[model samples]
Structure formats: C-alpha cells, structure tokens
Target: TSEDSEPWHIYTDLGYYSVELIAESQNCGADTLLIDSIIHVLNPSFISTIGNQDISIFPNPVKDKLYINFNKNLNNPMLLNIYDLNGKIIAQKDILSVAPGILELTFNRNKTQKGTYILRIQNTEETIFETKFILN
Candidate 1:
C-alpha cells in the first residue's frame, strides 16, 4: 500500500512475490508490500551497459568522420566538446537526440592540425566518456 510509500510486492497470475523495501522514517509503522501472483511468464533478459568504458573509436588515425557506439541509453541532448592538445576548445556540438544504439560523428580534420586532440562526451549531468585521437 502507499501508506508505507514503498513497493513491497509484485502480484502475478500465479502467486505473490515480495520485493525489497527501503525503509523510510515515515514508513516505520506501516509496512509496504508488492505482490506478484501471475504465471506463465517467459524469461526475458535486458542488457544495458553504462559509461564510456565500452565505447570504441574506429580509424584511430581518423581522417574524416568518427563513429561511436554504446550498449546503453545515453542522455538526451548529449554534449560533444573537442579540445586541442593545448586544452583549447576547437569544436563543440550538442547532440539534440540520441537513440539507444550506434552514433556517428563527423569531424573535418582538414581544419584541425595533424596532432593529438581530446574528445569529451558529456550527458545532461556528467561526462560520459573521453578519448584522444590523432590526425595524420
């Protein structure tokens, strides 16, 4: 019940299942419950990976566009900031929208010097990932 303001049980067609509850000071007296009593459920798996740890940059010695892929959903309106080796912001773009899949970023290396640069990807709150690349 909402008296405890916590999810206690999930109910399914077959039976009732209990869920872990986070006790709040206001819920000390009232017990929250979730009941699951359904049956004939299929086992489903949903995989989601976070952070930029698993991201890859192809054609490291990039000449043109850079491709980025993630296994998880990224924040809407992601921010891409490119900085030179001297820590100067060379380019910046706001990714208005992103799907839960692969993303491609095109950079005109012709304007950038043939050296190392830092690419920073920031979501709404924090920096999701960062990488360095060279243009040859």
Candidate 2:
C-alpha cells in the first residue's frame, strides 16, 4: 500500500504485531523493496473512569490467574467482581485496605464455562475499572 491509501480497519486481540509492506517489480533491476511497522493492541475491556491512569492488566487470555497492577491506589475498599456473559455474577471479593501498589489475585476457571467474561473493579459507590477476560 502507498501513503495515499486509506487506513485499514482490523479487529484483533491484545498483543504485539509486526507488519511488512513490499513492492515487487519485474522490469526493474531490483526484485523487491520492503518496509516494516509494529503495533501493540491493548485490551479495551480495561477502563478506568475515576481518573486512575496507572491501572493495567496482563495475560488477556488467562489460563488461571490474571495479574493486575496499579501504580496508585484509590484508598478505599476495592470491590472486585467477575461476571458471566449473561450478566450473572460468578465471583466477588472485597478488599478493605488496598495498598498503593500491585495486587495479585487468583481466578478459578473450573467454576465457570469456557468463554468471555467481564471483570469489574470498583468501590461501594462507583466503578473504577472494568475489563473483559476469557477463561480457558
């Protein structure tokens, strides 16, 4: 594709991607010319509405446990909940005192079916962060 070409719309999972563009010619002395580009797709399910810019999660297609990291803490009881696709609550937990650091939690995959689910992190009054995850 050339610079005047329109942008391509592609839907993909969270991961690193590398793309290459090549131009081939038969009459010219050169056989081909190539250029490369890279991109990273972050999980869109992870969103924070409380202005918490340091929240992040890893291992989108988690097998057992997902790692969540927050550079700053909300200083409140963080309510963590997992819900199925039908809006049914599958698991929930309440952390009374969350330190201004990383937190590790385990996910039991045996209780729920293998599919996409929603993970919500919030307080008693409002939601702070919400993201989607897949259980295998």
Candidate 3:
C-alpha cells in the first residue's frame, strides 16, 4: 500500500497487469473500481550472435563494482548497459575490446539502487549478451 498518490512498483513476472481500488466508509457502503491491463511488464530480450551461457559475471549480487568475466576474445568494441527493472538504462560504459580471461568493466554507480538489474553487452550490429543481476 502507498501513503501518497505517487506510483509504486509491483515486482512480478512479465505480463499485463490491472489495478483495482476499493473505497470503504463506516457510514456509506463500499465501492470498487478497476482498470484493466494498464501496466505491462515485458521481458528485456534481444537476438544476438552469442548465447546466454557463453558469458558469465561474477558476484551476482554486486555492491560497489561489477566484474564481467568471460573467456571469448572480442575485437569489436563492446557497449555495456546497466538497466533497472523498468527497462531504463541507469548506467553504461564503452569498452575497446575484451581479451581472453577475466575482465572487469566498471561504470558509474551513483544511480544504482537495490533491485534486480539487467546487464546488456552489445556491439554496433546487435546485442551480444544480456543477463540479470542484483545490486545490494
């Protein structure tokens, strides 16, 4: 429940949602109102050349920094994006290349909040990799 008139978040699976509001009074009877399919939660997905299991990032629940570890060598510059639950890009970074072995790509953390986030690594053509992580 919310105290003010501002909006709130309801963490759930990807699907359409409807809101229902009920008002009750001691003197008067109860009234109900519902708006169907107002909110839509979509899965952030994209077609890419690489598979999801091909890359891995350590410390799933990261705190200060995020380390992206992978074995594949990439010559193209990778575009890193950090997205919030609402599919908003909270932070991003551009890397020149990824050498074989463990590598870390750090970005600004001032806007990161405690919630599930999506880390998307892409190239100039299309999205290469995408996964979800938690921020503490």
Candidates sorted by TM-score, best first: 3, 2, 1
RMSD, every candidate, angstroms? 18.2, 11.3, 5.5
Worst 10 residues of 2 by lDDT: 2-11
**True-structure lDDT of candidate 2:** 0.68
Give each model a TM-score: 0.54, 0.58, 0.60
Highest lDDT: give the candidate number.
3
Q: Order candidates by lDDT, high to low.
A: 3, 2, 1
Better of 1 and 2 by TM-score: 2
- At residue 77, give the lDDT of candidate 3: 92
lDDT, candidate 1, 24-109, per-residue tens: 57646655455454333332112122357756566676777777766665547888888875689988888876666767777675
Q: Kindly list the per-residue Cα lDDT of model 3 for residues 36-60, writing each as its tens digit.
A: 9997778533322244465788786
lDDT of 1 at 17: 37
lDDT of each: 0.63, 0.68, 0.73
Runs in model 1 deviating more than 4 A are 1-51
Best by TM-score, which number?
3
